[model samples]
Target chain A: GAGVSQSPSNKVTEKGKDVELRCDPISGHTALYWYRQSLGQGLEFLIYFQGNSAPDKSGLPSDRFSAERTGGSVSTLTIQRTQQEDSAVYLCASSPAGDTEAFFGQGTRLTVV
Target chain B: AQSVTQPDIHITVSEGASLELRCNYSYGATPYLFWYVQSPGQGLQLLLKYFSGDTLVQGIKGFEAEFKRSQSSFNLRKPSVHWSDAAEYFCAVERGATLGRLYFGRGTQLTVWP
Candidate 1:
């Protein structure tokens, strides 16, 4: 794709239900990142991936939050148990390398009801 | 610890007026600075970035920002504001050693009134 792509632009789920958000990064990009944007909280770094491996998961909010990337192309973020506080916009970005400027996606807005 | 700070939560300006958005960051060394704009129901767009070289950097949509090392600030400025420029602006910083991790400040929402 010409730019980073995220699936299911918006999702509304009941509390305690699990949800999966997908991200497709730009082709040939070696670095991928996930961020969460909430009202007043600003953009929070969630994870960073180099190739197919996630080198930095320090930003994951909890154990329920897990992400994986395969073939260095597509990635998935799964929230095991959703909570009301989990409602936010999830953003994905890709860069040619770790230190370079990243291109961002439209993001998936997750709403936990 | 590295962090970005945007003190103004909301700002309003009349159309065609000059605008300035303040940002400050805390980092041990000089870091990569960036300004991004997010319109309602739209994704974030890069406004400008300061890596090295000249402190003043020009960005899209007639926006410019100056990077000051002493103050640890990167402020965005525009000579003339437009109605369409009303949006949420964010300031972000990346560490020199850290890769792919961008620390962002609480956004500043700008409202342009005619």
Candidate 2:
């Protein structure tokens, strides 16, 4: 079966710019999550979506970050006026339900110069 | 808040040698523990997880982890090492009530030398 996939394996952008990262979860998966991994830091949760309800945005660092999922299959994360601090590997994952293990995508390495 | 700790930032082992990666966690209740491996240019892949019941759980790629409730530890181990196993290993602990958020450790980088 096809696993989760993310586009633009590597991305470079100037500071104050905007960027969008896309993810395609496994078929039939109902739970989606986004995380950020910095240089020497642990994976930081950004947002989560389950069954089309309001997504959990508490983990999102600031208003600059937002994500959307359409038809319960694909997701896109948008960063507005990105900063150098936003430079990191953005990872996406999906699970069958709340308690199951989540599978991850290869990630989009975002670099803000 | 729930948190995870991987005391050793890096570990080096020779091929065919035994391997152990330590993980410690802090949570209010019984925690859901997991080990994941991230190869270069790839996403994290689940190695194993511990929910309830058996203290020892087996996972993909010939890996296993043991949860020691008394010590707040869930260490991952393999009887022998392979060069392919060289990667970043992260320990994660999910609080029972948190639902979807997984708190991850800083990670341990394994170097397998032949």
Best by DockQ: 2
Docking class of 1: medium
lDDT of 2 by residue, A22-105 (tens): 999999988888999998666998888886653577888999999999898888999999999999999999988755698999
lDDT of each: 0.92, 0.90
In candidate 1, position A21 carries an lDDT of 99
Worst 10 residues of 1 chain A by lDDT: A95-104
TM for candidate 1 is: 0.97
Residue A20 of model 1 has an lDDT of: 99
Q: Encode model 1's per-residue lDDT on A19-73: one tens digit a residue.
A: 9999999899989999999985779999999999987999999999999999988
Query: Total clashes, candidate 2?
Result: 0
Q: What residue runs in model 2 are displaced by over 4 Å at the alpha carbon?
A: none
Estimate the TM-score of every prediction: 0.97, 0.96
The most accurate candidate by lDDT is 1
Q: What is the lDDT of residue A35 in candidate 1?
A: 97
